[model samples]
Target chain A: MNNIILKVENISKQYRLGLVGTGTISHDLNRWWHRVRGKEDPFLKVGAVNDRSAATKENYVWALRDINFEVQQGEVLGIIGKNGAGKSTLLKILSKVTSPTTGEIKTKGRIASLLEVGTGFHPELTGKENIYLNGAILGMTKAEIKQKEQEIVEFSGCQMYIDTPVKRYSSGMRVRLAFAVAAFLEPDILVVDEVLAVGDAEFQKKAIGKMKDISRGDGRTVLFVSHDMGAIQSLCDRLIVLKNGYVDFSGDIPGGINHYLKISELGSSMNYANVATDFGIEKVTFLDKDRQEVNSVMVGQKLVIRVDYKNFDKRNLSLSIGFLDNFSNFKFACRSDVLDVTYKDNIGVAYMTIDKWPLSEGSYHYNLAVHESSVMLQNIKEAGSFRVEKGDFYGTGKLPGKRGSFYIEYQWE
Target chain B: MNTKHKDEWLYTISSKRKLIDFNFKEIWRYKDLLFLFVKRDIVTVYKQTVLGPLWYLIQPLFTSVIFTLVFNNLGNIGTGGVPPFLFNLAGITAWNYFKECLTKTSSTFTTNKGIFGKVYFPRVVMPLSITISNLLKFGIQLGIFLGFYCFYFFQGTEANMNQHMLLFPVYVLMMALLGLGLGMIISALTTKYRDLSILVGFAVQLLMYLSAVPYPISEAREKFPSKVALIVEYNPLTQITEGFRYMFLDTGTFTWFGFFYTLIISIALFLIGLVIFNRTEKSFIDTV
Candidate 1:
């Protein structure tokens, strides 16, 4: 018997670039005329690549371009990509929420998706009633939900309010209860699309832990899509990296993450607004102690950086700066939201300052991104690189004990 | 596993689907869901309202009263010796069933877009649930209708229940299927051309007047313009309403020709609706 539980072959989805309206009727009639005569769709032959940043000349764009992959039984596959890189489109097609414009998908057994939690839950219904309703919507039999209702309640920790209408429950409680019902589904193949992005950190951890158990212990095939690289690294056995509607990398998890990280390297050029959608960081400059632009800074001095950004919407953006090592490992990120940094104008400058930078002599690169509500609008890896030259420590003009990325000053007790 | 089941795939999803891709087996497997959706509809519809389930009876009662005032009293329309209240109630009862089923099932794609976009199930289940759920409402209204039926009977009226009343369930089934069939076609079309949604609202309202809901077909044929009367004569709803009134009140036109004509038309429309709905179900989410 074959172990492959799901097989996708040459799947692609094309979407009209603008509003779908009376204008499409003509094109639909044309397509129908061709189809009636046993000919291919006339419009399918021409479409632009899926790139939100670039301006499109054609009205049709392929959301997922000729996607093909397979999942083996019990293997957790991670799909990581930027917002419009066809991650959600591919998941939608796989779950049959929408069909591909071309090609097909072959599956071995039952496939269910947690595209959004509490999908069919009626807010007027009690929590207990919702369990049955949501469970049935997810393709679970009544007897199956009945058999595991107790465990689901216990897991959600909402047993006290199980009989209350969901309208009275908090949003967090709704998510917990909804996920509890879905967790007990135990389908042969589960396609999850970042549904864990909800709730607090603790519940997310518990949910991820439960998913790992489902795949590892029960041997179920899972296709997980998320932007949280930490969760992907911990939960997925294999990974697929999508870039602009194409499979950029598909293999071992570590290699795929590295490739994904390197995809945004060297975005240092000036003025991206012409091509970028919504918003993009136009320029990044590193300033020295004297407020002079420089490529390198001395260790033990302040790390001063200035980021120039532009937006079409003029909405306040949450800027993030992350430091990565040469091996593409993310060390730390400084988020503007953490420090109450915000800019409301369409074009504004953002400054990130780290007083008394503690580091040894080495080269390091930082990534820049503009975010709104955790959804990244623009992301640039290796936005700029800087070198740290040694500076006098303790006024002794002498080096620390050993040279490393981080330098620590200590005295023996 | 048997050798026959060795290479079997549970399902295959693609663009190349047959014209009538009805998944009877999938709908069967999700039978529990169908009933649960129906329960949700019945239970939640009256939640948080003051009148609650009473609203169902109030609507038909008020509509029949207005019909009595406007069409019966004002228009001087005769009911073939049957009381005007009973005459209009019978037509309204049957019309409401078809109207509710058609309107509810017609918006299946738009109303359930949130759930449909996130999950996969037999798309037919949602509309089928509407047809079934509306039956419960119809049943409750029938209680009120039966109350009126007994009130008029004991008080002595020309109308009397006969053997044709035995086909009551059959009539109800035909109306439900006809509404669902026509609604599914409108629903599938509305997924892309949303303007049809606006059109469907007034079309249904206009259709009620065109049918024999507020008046009898024999009277309309006698008084109405030839073209208008001809349209009313061929309408499937006119036949169903007329047959229902004939069965209960012992009035209106009823013939084997009209009965089979409606039966065949309803079944044909329903099968055609299923084909178009199946094709739209696959990709409606994109346009919707």
Candidate 2:
């Protein structure tokens, strides 16, 4: 009976879009009247899906619709999504911070939500006082907090400033103390919403260890939401991807992550006709050494790039391709002049070949340029991107974790 | 709807809830949170201030003095043949408590939208905590009133203290309930229509005049028209203020009918406020 600790049944939340003003009350009035008459809520028939980017003539959107899931005892489930994907909304509903518009969620035990660290923290309260207050806000009784006060203080490393008001603690120390209190919560189910995104790296490690302990050791269930793929890969046994407020994918960690990777990848081929110069690139295609087009390739594999151009004005211009990381920061560039290649013709093609692509396991975007004698002709940034999966870079099948966006070939004696 | 899992599940969260489910057990479970919130309010209010707790006494004292100067001396309003200063002091002391509970609790949702959005607890804990927290301030203000009460008693004036003083605690309870109840109603309404919150500050101030805080009910009856006098008589806060003046200075009218009428109304408003408050708390975060 206790095997399934939580069951979410057909949970959905409909939200009225735009400003909540006069029209909102009229809709509320209409819904109430319908409810009194034993009719379904008219707004429940909203057709628009929740897409924050688009404009809508309709007044309503379904933030979450018929979301169904269950958590077994001691299982860690990760909810991965982009911004406004209703991750926070689902967590809020599960923790009873808000109620779902339709259906229900049945849970067997206590649910503690860490939507944010230090909920109800008063800056004027001393660190020790805030610990008790924060713990109580998280549904802990006074006696329970008192018993764990010493351990919480030690974990926070804020023993010296226990009596000092939290207003004086540095932002980092405050997060430490808040997270420390959170770590001690003995709830049967914990709902975390990107709370691990804060705090230092070492503290985050400790917090993650504590979360693992809470779920694995104590047999409590956890529903975690985070954008960090590594944390999801390490902590969650199961994963669900939410896109536009719907469950787009759900499965084992690696499978869900791969599905997420594919969904998040952008176009691999792009045309440059509109941005063409006198001697400009017409198109760019990412390919393997076999000349087969691909959007993703293994690490340390040969990557061949083909650039088709139209040298209408017949200018002596050299082609260039620059690889950029996620932030659009240039890591390295490939210039045609490296091989003393320059072109001045009616139309032509260019290529950049790397025997071993050195970028680490991550998605990389690239830019294109055509220049003549230090005078830039056409520079198109963020032209296209491709993904690189992990591979056995060395002969040994061992790989160090991601330190940066590079894997250069080197040797030592 | 199924019977097998219904009883086994410890909690069920859904869109529809009982209209009058106060969930007192949940509030009781969060008693520690309630206590800490009360402590935080009381302690943080006076922090880094030079006067600190003295400001509690000074607030009513200064208000009483101002009322004495403006309403009694300048406007020539008599205080039942007793010293106008003490009479005004008594009314202001009780008025401050009611106003404090009302103004602070009326904005519970707006003031606490941050914590409420991020966490789940009985939302009533906030207003209940405010009501309890303001008690400490009211207690101190009562102490100051009593200090003056003894000073005048020894002076051997016509301010006769009576057995009506036995109802003092009852009067304090009614004030808190009325303030807290009205505040809950307004705050709940404000979660959707925020214009209601903007009206609370000035509304409470204007209400003090109608509640007979600066002057006694007897004066309002004698000076104003019968309809306006009826309005003052029917105001619930008028009963508590008159009860306090009667207890401390023996200078205001207090009838059993008016007293219980206000009491019944306070209890009714409180229950109604609780229902609205409970309904709003369940889903206010969406609108707020």
Candidate 3:
């Protein structure tokens, strides 16, 4: 077994809710006085847990609380959570960009975090100069950057404009250059926070390939935080799921991913409100052909989406529904005009059914929109979501698992 | 993968804020970052400007002429027999270094919020770079002052260059330390109380008058009341500037007691600044 490279014990961060200047001084003084008298901080006990959904009377909230974990050398750990889950806070603390409010982290080697790409790049500086500056900011020595300078430029594919100022480069080129500098950083422990969310599809593939090489070839530990479940499932050896500033799950990749998906389904299901009160969508729900409200369906089962609307006005209104993969990439879309459906009712439900769904096993979200002859009335992205389980589609007792987003009919010669 | 061998260092970060945890070795290890930051500050400042580094010479030159017009011609402030232009240039050159360092470093957290929010480095590297970069500007301004000094000296004016001039480096170091110290203190405090940032510019300008930059302390002592004279005399920067004039131009009140007092005060302020800066750097990102 590889040795444990990092240990985080009971790390918690408490932040004041509002303007900290006026009230903070008194708290600072009170804490100082109590420390002088050898007493525990009286305010430390008064903070509420970081539950963004709930209203609280206390002025202080813990963004992270009692977070404990350990990482073995060469292990890729994925942290997954919904928004306000404190994942970024934990990464910030681990990166030493900010200190924890309580608890300790023990580490053995250097940690380089790409909390953001192009973090310290100056727009006026040339790409070459920014490579050096950003590399140094990411904890690479000057000599080391010089050694990798050629490789970084080549990898970024911006060698033609290495001496040109970054401000002159396209946004895609900038992200590529920034990612190249960070990818060359050879720290023992690497912490990446959604850096792969940048660049085009080709560059993202290249970036993920590079990360995999870094983790596998050098036997370095990697802490990756991303909302892209497909990438997380493929890249991580283990996972930690955070919810409301607490560790909701920590185990193997599938277990943690399952827990996270379950929580997300629960969270998103509640958001099925009438988002736009004026000529708006009232609710969206997912069900099976049996008309039962199903949280998920087998890949080949009949999947139905029911979108309820209000204030329709019966004015030649058309509705469109789109299916998106976990990364929010649209897989397919269907419009009511194509189906030759017209709604005359002011408030009613429109159901879009897909017989023998062609999607592979993964989580997907539905986006709904209503338009009156092209003038958009209501558009709700990610109105509801459902999971697709593995099922045989080709009448062979086999299914495509984590291969791609969909299934296509084929004939074997 | 040797289980029997333990790592050389174990870093533990807790909520407990230590009073003084300045890691000099870590700063040393990141010295390359410090150098690059200094280079960035110097190179980027004059990139698109027409006059470029020439602005360095122009700033002190114009300020000296203005001082000659207002402080010398109008206010009748004596320069102790040294030409008013030369005297004003000398004081401005020295004060400019300290002022630049103080104001730039004072906004470290606010100005570098983008960088500090993303990555981890020795936070002191930023202020250290400002001090170094400002020192370069100070050097250029000093060179101009020397050019003017040579013209006055060749004209056979009563310009005195004494053996004490060898202590110029010491004076520069003292000014840098004092500026860095005060800058760090203000920067740390300004992270939470943003109003202090607004006060820094005005306060530094007022401090310049108090430090006798445009007027010598001896003249201020003769002109002002006794209480005001005592305040000007006790100002640490006043002694530093006065000693600088005594060394370079060889005419000003140069007392061993004043030198020692300024030395003690600058060192004390530096230590206090370090303590507070160290404490603030850990979590200032949250507030800033």
User: Which candidate number maximizes lDDT?
Assistant: 3
Q: Which wins on DockQ, candidate 2 or candidate 3?
A: 3
Q: What share of the true interface contacts does each candidate keep?
A: 0.89, 0.82, 0.79
- Alpha carbon RMSD to native, model 1: 9.4
List of chain A TM-scores, every candidate = 0.69, 0.80, 0.75
- Name model 1 segments beyond 4 Å from true: A265-413, B1-7
Candidate 3: residue A131 lDDT (0-100):
95
Please give the lDDT score at residue A100 for candidate 2. Answer: 93
Please rank every candidate by TM-score, starting with the best: 2, 3, 1
DockQ for each model: 0.50, 0.51, 0.53
- Candidate 2, residues B45-109, lDDT tens digits: the string is 98999989998888888888998999989999988887888999888889888898888889999
Instruction: Report every candidate's CA lDDT.
Output: 0.86, 0.86, 0.87
Question: All predictions: root-mean-square deviation over Cα?
Answer: 9.4, 4.8, 5.0
- Candidate 1 lDDT tens digits, A130-154: 9999999999999999999999999
Cα lDDT of model 1 by residue, B1-288, tens digit: 112453577788787878767778889999999999999999999999999999999999999999999998999998988899988999999999999999999999999899899999999999999999999899988889889989988998778877888888888988998999999999999998888899988999999999889888988889999999999989999999999999999998788899889899999999889898988999899889
- Candidate 3 lDDT over B231-281, as tens digits, reads 999999999888988888987889889988888888898899888988898
Candidate 2: segments with Cα more than 4 A from true spot: A265-413, B1-7
lDDT score, residue A229, model 3?
84
Per-residue alpha-carbon lDDT of candidate 2 for residues A126-148, written as tens digits (9 for 90 to 100): 99999999999999999999999
